[model samples]
Target: MQFDRDRFRFGIEAEYLLADKATFRPLWHNDVTFAELHNLMEAIPFDDLPSMDGLELEPPHRKLMPYVVEGYHVPNPDFSPIDILPKGVEIRTPVCSSIGECLECLKTLHDRLEAALSGSGYTLVSLSHHPTEHHFEGPQNKRRYDFWQWAMEVMTTCGPDINVSLPRELNDPIDVADLHRKVNYYSPALAALSLASPIYRGKLWKIRGTVGKSIRTYRRSVIAPAIELHPEENGRMEFKLFEATNRLEDYHAFFLLWLTLLLDEGLKGRSRDQSRIYDLGAVARFGLEAETVRERAGEVFAQAPVVLNRHGFDAGPLNIMKKRLETGRLPADDIIDYFDETGSLEDVLKTRTGLIHGTELAQDSSVNAAALSRSRQSMTGI
Candidate 1:
């Protein structure tokens, strides 16, 4: 079945860690911050959010709540309320007909969350893993908590689940299988672009005391799929490999990248599960520094423009990704460098907490692309 890009919908479920405004440390499950935020959100009127004309608002948004108290603390039938512990909150967008709309919706919800946290002595920070907490003590009877247990009790890591709705035409088994194969092939390399988790267990992660990049992905990749269909949502493919980022432009770029891959019929690259697992490990450790990861990512980025253009979309958002490839530096590298220079995790969290909210709608692709081109030309003496 052929996909008509015009009808495609996009959304995001972004998770953030809660931090103490003063100490910049991870907030515990018992903190009053959770209840305060929840109460404030409940008090907000639906009219506070900007209205999107001609768009169908769904679920949480339709119910006037776009943000929720998420993470390990959220109680379910399997886990009693007493056993539940809060870690952070998740902000999600209603299904949107375009990438721009989706981002706008996300920004709206995030802004609301920031407003609610104002003067509450708490703030949200985007980090793939907890910077200080090495372990969390919790009940361990359920098999579902295996990864959480392995990662040390609470899954302190927070990341975005990039969702794209598949049209009914592409819901058949043949198309679904093909989509899975392509996603597996490209996810490892694409994931390397968003490696923002360099520090883990209170220090820079070291493999046998060597430097490490993303402990979250390095460990989670073995157990999770690069892409999976949302069990409850019909035809929605969730790209699960990316780490969290504070920059709105990063999400802009990532969504477009995945959408391009989903729409591209000419790019038939496929990989077995074992090969993807192997590749993901290298990426999780060194990011683009690994030659295999860089080359594989380069191929996808090179082809992204053609696919995006064919779908009547701009490829300008990809400038940030191209710059990352050119410099061989992902977010984790910058974070590690900052921590090295400051010698304080609190200092790092201070800056990141401030960036938890964003108002920018999209990347200035034209400006970015022009600047990048000039830099490349000068470097090559062209």
Candidate 2:
């Protein structure tokens, strides 16, 4: 298959704690700070390979350097990538436009770095989080310092730390509008799926989704239209509704219903069968629920229409019903009644089709359905 640059490009920006050449302990005594580190690294001949921590440091670009520097105050003594730091060490490799290329790059870099570091009696590791190590400072390089300072300022004003990752599936170059939709749709789901940081500062926080909370905070501070909780007077859970709109709307109603049924069955008793059912049910429920509402809305199209309209569009009231059902804002039976009352299913379909296909729907108002649909189809080949 021909490589799809948009879909196939994969890159990894990893941050690893700097460890001592021996005993694999965090290195705390470097005179050159992160800002200085970048400058110094940049000044070093790109062609001149350095043997540090037993790894050979080769610049990715002949004009500049390969290492994208990030610094932390904490000392990570372990070789496990997990124990790196909170705002720990970061390693940014070259941008690979394909997954195969990316994997190859990772392998090559890993091998070279390991060999170079081995000579120095040290190694590098990869992981998401670590529980043991703490205490670190940002890099000293002017650019790195500026970035960390800005990030800290924004985050401090917001709430907490947030981290997120998305599947490689949506990496393809998509229409700007479709990209927006997919980003808006999958962000919440990905946030939910990748929420692994539960215990922070050695305490069990009540937040069920640590990663989501962190991201929510980041979006509020860094991203525009920061998420605000509905006031008690408003009688609304702000985040809840947002999640429903973005992810739930894109999921299949039957799939969601199946999950709900499983959950119900699992919660009925404490038997081993019930426990097993509950586990499966829980995973399904969370997985489906995490999907963005817009994505869910897309999934609704996959279902066979129970009712069709004069235009031959399956835009039955079922779509609306599905939305309400997924959102828990209305009873399933009530949705059916509402669907019966709604006009032509084709009209409804047109409305949804318009919403999805519209260009820059989030940022622009002039986009139309036909344009949006064509753009999406062209990008995804759907």
TM-score of each: 0.82, 0.36
Q: Write the per-residue lDDT of candidate 2 for residues 243-336, one digit (tens) a residue.
A: 1111112222222221121112121112232332232223223433432433433333333231112112223323544444355332212222
Candidate 1 deviant stretches above 4 angstroms: 1-6, 30-37, 48-64, 73-83, 140-154, 170-174, 231-234, 354-382
Best-performing candidate as measured by lDDT: 1
Model 2: lDDT to the true structure: 0.29
The clash tally of candidate 2 reads: 47
